[model samples]
Target: MKFSITTLSALLLVSAASVAQADSYADAIKSWCGGLAVTAPKTSTVVVAGAKTKITVTRKADERTKTITGLDLYSVSKDGKAKYVQNVWKGNYALKSSATISDAVPKNVPAGLYYYRVWVTNLIGKQHGPDCLETSRTFKVTTGSHTNAAGDLEYTESLHDNSIYNPEHEVGCFGLSVDYPKAGDTFKLNQHIHIQANRDAASQTDALTKVELYKGDQLINTAWTGSESFQNSFSLKDHLVLDNADTTSDYHYKIHATSKKADKTCVFKSGDFKISN
Candidate 1:
């Protein structure tokens, strides 16, 4: 069908106006969303294990109908890899001007490197909008063994001496803790001992290259390999059986790990244990 020139011109004007209206609406939505700002616990702050810490952040959105959803912690490796540790707080609270969230570092969280991030859910009309995230700077977690005059644990920043801080290495074990066979514990011969190590919040890119059992200077057996190793918890009971032949001396285990991104290998050793016939 043929259309008059005036009719076609009117249609074009209407289409152009529609496009401009849509663009304006998009810009308005973008402006409605807010940017989160973290002001406290500055970068490179040292946090003690088993201690309480506070985070302060402000929402800068034009809309004030936002809810603080979560405050989460993450473990960061030297190779710039991050893994979620735990949720310090998870709830819905109407945010006014700013808020201070408090959470204690888990006592069992091994001394390592970590950081915190805040999650906020914005309210668009009556529905919840997408979650917004603002990550804080990296922090250090110390063992917190020493105390000052007030009995508060004294925290001193550690030097970068290990693989975790080494520039040449891309991967390293953060908090390698043995779960079984405490030091000085004795196990009966022919007993099945479950050997396990917890690689606390290590990066997913890192893999266990070697897990070996040792007695003195001699190597006993390779417990697990990176190709078949567990990600967070390394356990190998089927390959580790205490026999009469293993009762000659004190025993220990070693773990070696590597990341695909680096050439350096991370090593960890367990305390001495014993086996008796």
Candidate 2:
């Protein structure tokens, strides 16, 4: 969905000078044509996949405004490039108006942070102002069901229930276990913590790249097979010990894993397990 420079220039009345003239591209577009203002989702909107997003846009095509013949919606890329994701609205003749664009986020869209912008196209089908309102013009996608091949993570204190700990009763590297940590499951400081990454039965070929424990954004510990991938299932049995000076706060530990079969490099996080002294 990458737009060509020529097409973009023609659509957005952006001159090479405007791009080079200002350090901030958005500011340059604003200077060029005052910019079309997007007035919905004042904050960073969370767009769950397969859901409808109601977007409201307004543009004034007067002497003070740039001629807006058409309106386009684009998702901004990591490299600060705009990729046309959807055409929210269009006009055969340029006029001043306001419209609400209801766009359905694709069910299979990748889970990550996304930013969208409205591009105003001129009478000749040339696009103008790449108006991305404000610095916080972004949205988020939580989980894509299609990419979530790994099952939910599990935890148990009983070795009998989790045969992976019992050498004689072990089934493969890890055994079939249940009694995963519930929403209110909490662990004591310095207690034996056992969590298992339930490999998707359908994704037996996918390699378990790594398993990590995190407290908020800080990494607590990690376990990964050296150069090889864990064949099917993996288990992490470690003592839950908070830093000596961090006794006052009850922190929640998060488990994340990377799967080769899912082709996802970004770690997929599971539910949080509370920890306390």
lDDT of 2 by residue, 137-187 (tens): 345544432323476432222223322122211111211121244445677
Model 2 has a clash total of 8
Report lDDT (CA) for all predictions. 0.62, 0.43
Lowest-lDDT window of 10 residues in candidate 2?
Answer: 168-177
Tens digits of lDDT, candidate 1, 108-215: 776666667777777767876656666664556776657779997655535354544333222333445566656887766545566676755434224567778789
Highest-scoring model, lDDT: 1
RMSD of each: 19.6, 21.3
* TM of each candidate vs. truth: 0.45, 0.32
* Clashes per model (N, Cα, C within 3 A): 0, 8
